[model samples]
Target: MRALDLTLVLTNMPTTTTLRLSFSPSPPRPLSNRACPHGPVISQLDFFAFLNRHGSFLTPLSCCSLEVDRRRRSPITMLSYDSTSNVLANQFQVRELNDETDFETILSADGRFSVCGFGSLLSERSARSTFPDLVNFRFARLNGFRRVFAHVTPVFLERGIARPETKEISGLSVEPCEGESLTVTVFEIEKSEIPAYFEREIEYRFLAVLPQTLDGKPFDNPAVLCACYSDEEFLRVRCKGSKEMFFQLYGQYNIDKIWQDDILPCRAYLRHCVLAAKKLGDEVYDNFLDHTFLGDRKTTIRQHLATKGSGIMEEEPPESLKIRYGG
Candidate 1:
């Protein structure tokens, strides 16, 4: 599969005019409804009609299937069907293409570094706080690694301190898994932000990775990978949490008092990661849920909710855990 950066162009036109969009480094091919094999062929008139009706609700950089070189690939593009001339005008004003050329300059320029984030950093809100001048971000996959909860953190260790009898909990890490691939968000930010990012990730160590987009396009620049708790470290530190604790906290769907106190922050972080995945859309989100692990197993939010019920019905975080984690 090939990656294409697309641009939408609208010429002086009337309300009934056809919408036209262009792709850089490639020309537009005949648009087809590849989504449905036996469905009616989508004509320009049908496309325009649908756009005029639902255009306002559509996100500017939404993903859509396009036939390219005899294969279907999803390219980042803006397409709108507007009933009014100003609708197109308004949409274009709000969204502009951040082209690959600009991205390359930002990547090659000084005071910039590429980091692969697989956790809370995947969230736009979290990443934006650190890198206000974030150049770009995209979905990428790291092969030969699997995410796990193998690193003992200060917060969990603090919990252990408070209740010396309670088993210690650990945070997330990536371990080598031959033939496995871990989905990550590869983004570029100013070098000035590196120190703060590292501070937040005190347990992780940086490793170099040649990042590849989901479509197998290798990034030109090497990405900084933050990893923790290799097999050796896992064995030496015995960072694994009590299997009993894992089942009690995450195995069921309900939020027990212990879960609210000890597991809520981590669950909150996981929610952020899920939100980021959702922003990428369903296919990407499904892939993320499939590959990611909570403690020891891959579980979906639906499964969690079915088991635990909603937060509204759950009890508050226990005072002890709140004070311990400084929540």
Candidate 2:
């Protein structure tokens, strides 16, 4: 059999009479050495690099340094060996490391840290060329949608980071679906240090994968409800409750105005949604519209492009009266 080499630092000198050795079948055996008394000794297992003809294998023992204070000497020792192998599959194993070694690697993956990191990256100017082409969409509006409008709120709508970040947005992201639908996961990278009443700001990140393409191109006039304020009509979402509800309510409210011909200012609405979504956590939820837009976004955009008056004013003719100077 192959021997594994291991060394231990002795605080209390171990004469041959006091020395002892133990072995566990799981790790094979450590090479024994009593040949040297003045220096470090090598074990037989350390001599050969064991080759794996097929399955996976673990190093015979745990490698760690042993500290000796008496003689001011520190030596290395092996503790345990663990491995996993499958006859027809690849082998895998998880080695348990010391607490100090493992924690340093995992700290960055914690929830709060992720939120803050994303928030920092988002605060900078966003690039706009990444989105798809649209007939009437302005680059500026697209930029707003990507960075501010569609983004999540810093405060989690569900209270904690355990729930997806998407819960905080307009509140329309997550819901039960029967047919083709979307699943969105949202996370807040950072909650702003400032209190809500003071500035009410947050930064967030969100992601959604949908089975069907939103295909905004097909809708006669698709519009993003964008944002809203603290009002009962907008789903009664308090800072403590579901922010997703707020987004849903805001969308419905906008649609109400569209049907009533009391069209709200699109830019203002978008800006509000952007800021509101940020404050809720850092991330917010949104999805493709299921129903028709109460108002036709395409029609509105066309009107803006034409820049012409409609109805009676369009039909009216200019008067023949001419201005006279110095008559």
Among the numbered candidates, top TM-score falls to 1
Off by over 4 Å in 1: 1-109, 155-170, 230-265, 297-327
lDDT string, candidate 2, 1-327, tens digits: 333344444343232222133333334234322111111344334422221211123332322212123311222221121223211222222211112222122122231111111111111221011111212221111111111112233232232321232121222111111122221111222122113211232111111111111332111111211122222222222323456554453333322211111232222222322333343342222211221011222223224223321231122112321110000
Instruction: Report the error of model 1 at residue 259, Å.
Output: 19
* Per-residue lDDT of 57 in model 2: 31
Provide the RMSD of all predictions against the true structure, rounded to 1 decimal.
15.8, 24.7
TM-score of the candidate numbered 1?
0.46
Q: What local lDDT does model 1 show for residue 181? A: 75
Give candidate 1's error at residue 78 in angstroms: 36
lDDT (Cα, tens digit) per residue for candidate 1, span 168-246: 2435555444345777887887766655665555345444555567876556666666554233222222224444544
Candidate 1 residue-wise lDDT at 10 = 46
lDDT of candidates 1 onward, in order = 0.47, 0.22
Q: Which stretches of candidate 2 lie over 4 Å from their true place?
A: 1-188, 192-232, 239-261, 264-303, 308-327
Q: lDDT (0-100) at residue 56 of candidate 2?
A: 25
Backbone clash pairs for candidate 1 read 51-81, 52-81, 111-191, 253-307, 253-308, 254-307, 254-308
